[model samples]
Target: MNLPQSPNNAPDADDDLEPVGPRPRPKGIYALPNAITLSALFASFYAIVMAMNGRFETACIAIFAAAVLDSLDGRVARMTNTQSAFGEQMDSLADMVSFGAAPALIVYQWALKDMGKLGWIPAFVYIAGAALRLARFNVNIGVVDKRYFQGLPSPAAAALVMGLIWVVDDAGIKGVGRVDWAAWSAFAVTLFAGLSMVTNAPFYSFKVFGGRRSVPFIVLVAIALGIAVVSLDPPRVLFALFCAYGLSGYVIYGIKKSRGKPVSVIATSTDEPDEEGLHR
Candidate 1:
């Protein structure tokens, strides 16, 4: 007959080890980046409030301020090594409010509201596009080429629309006959900005500048000059810059197609296990 097994036998030890479930999320989120995101969200809300009060220019400025804050939060998170899933989700939600809903509502109030029910359609379309764009971005963040965005980013699209309003308002162009033209212009820009958000065209993402990259001294000089030029005529200069950027994706797409390069913005599938379902 076989002897009885000891309490510390290998099979008993294996049985005593319980299976672990999936790891729980960290106990607390990083605060700084989320605070910045909340500030951006407040800026968006302020933009909407100012728009309602007929302070369109101030509202436009608020959107720009939100954009600046939005840009900072991600960099801050990355730099401080405090990135978290919560921060990413918060940032996207803030972006939707600031870059998507705020712009649509502001433009509608500034121009589209007077066009009857038809006036609101474009705004709704824009809101929808922004939602779709943000959702796709969240899902595809791991899959896309870091150097390029598959469609116009929502913030840039908001800039294109708000920039037009800012420049026109700065020029004091909202009287009688001018109001009608401005309204139509706002309508067109809003439509273009909204539709562009859902396009397949690839927009250049300036992600290449991050990390330990060194820059030439001339870059600093250029930045100073650019700041001075913007100071000289903030509305006109900023609007012109964003307009060019808003159209750049089509330019890049056309160039790539003409050169016989595959123009699809989707990053190619890789052999890595995590990337299996991430082709787009």
Candidate 2:
């Protein structure tokens, strides 16, 4: 009285069953690296808020703090074996806001605004250069040498701008209260920095951590003392120092290139290469 099986059906039904594939599940998130990235993002957001509130010095400091946090997140990820595509992209986005847009806006509002249409030009230029630098970094991540950045890093460029602002604010270099000339000069400086960020000049990528051999204790103490001094008057000291660092790369590179030296020659990274870590 049993029902007949279809012609296509196997007598041993279990034998005819297909293997069950692994079920798809949601991706697991890494907490530590993501936390660092979130902190960086918050730092950048706070910088913008401070800048808007006319707390220009605080905003600049916030941006620099964000840069420190931003630098740490990637290293932390690599050290903890938690590196991910999501973290890399997030870091770049945070950098664009903190280093790219924030500095440009701060400069524009603080000084460039007096230059009328010209004031906005440098802001746009810096932003565009930052975008290009980030895009190039992402694309060449695994292809470029890590020991040297292809161009001036965006954070350094932002630092230069903020440092200049801090110097001016601290020094109380006034008399431009309603002057177009001062505003235009600020705009011009911004434009130059923006262009420099994307230039082919080589900048020392302070990527190496604690690998230096043979430094006198006195030299170390002197460096620490210098940092302390700069901290006391960061606007004047740090700004001038970073500005010179930013410009020096271009001058050195130009001289080298004119003397028939190859611009692409750069120092190689000592660390083992990862698919995600590349510099050109």
Candidate 3:
């Protein structure tokens, strides 16, 4: 009803219209990537359960499985263009379980538990390092160099701790809690891994290898040989490889420092240009 038309024939304002509220958040998550993350979380849970049962070898294997799944989920999310904030948060939380708490608990249960009060030190330090590392990574994701990680990644640190257990357990070492040398070695490795994670040393992330870039034919051959070697003696070889990697950050840091190169991987905050796919 055009009862009170203005000069431009505008309609009279109504007083009965309901005010619009803020939009509701969407409920569901992307299935494929999040499912992989959930699987990783389940693997961590299984590892903890296995550790409780004194099945440490199985527990170590479960953590490794979780690491593999953890690595895949992000790639899968990017590949399928399903990278969501939800998936990112889920991945970080799953990582905390798999790499943070699970390794600490497993290592403690295996060897550290025998050390009385001293045992909890390294275990607690390891978990704390994981928490700090994860938090730093999340905050620095966009600013840090893609070629390098700020420090030893939590998954790799987890591997360092779990690999010690796996190698000893595979060697048929029984009653780890009673073995002084083994427990001491576990303590040292766990401590080293924990400290390595919180350092400013830049670790090579290997992100460039799988991307759409051309590498030498020797790279493929090297990967194949590496796999074959790992398959021969999974426990010993994996532990050895991870051990080398555990020390690599400091080596790189030393080299960079000696050369007077910038050690931190973080980009300068001049223009703050957002790179595509960097935030997730």
Error of 2 at 100 (Å): 1.1
Q: What pairs collide in candidate 2?
A: 141-278, 144-279, 144-280, 145-279
Model 2: residues >4 Å from true position, as ranges?
1-27, 173-181, 211-222, 265-280
Cand. 1 TM to true fold:
0.87
Supply every candidate's count of residue pairs whose N, Cα or C atoms clash at under 3 angstroms: 0, 4, 0
Q: What is the Å distance of residue 175 in model 2 from its true position? A: 8.6
Candidate achieving the largest lDDT = 3
Candidate 3: where are CA atoms >4 Å away? 1-28, 270-280
Tens digit per residue, CA lDDT, model 2, 126-211: 99999998997787666565656778889888888887777666666653426566566667777878898787777767555344
* lDDT leaderboard ranking: 3, 1, 2
The C-alpha stretches of model 1 lying farther than 4 A from their native spots are 1-27, 175-178, 270-280
Task: Give all candidates' CA lDDT scores.
Answer: 0.87, 0.77, 0.91
User: What is candidate 3's lDDT per residue for 110-225, written digit by digit as tens?
Assistant: 99998999999999999999999999899888779999998899999999999999999999998887998999999999998888888888899999998578999999999999
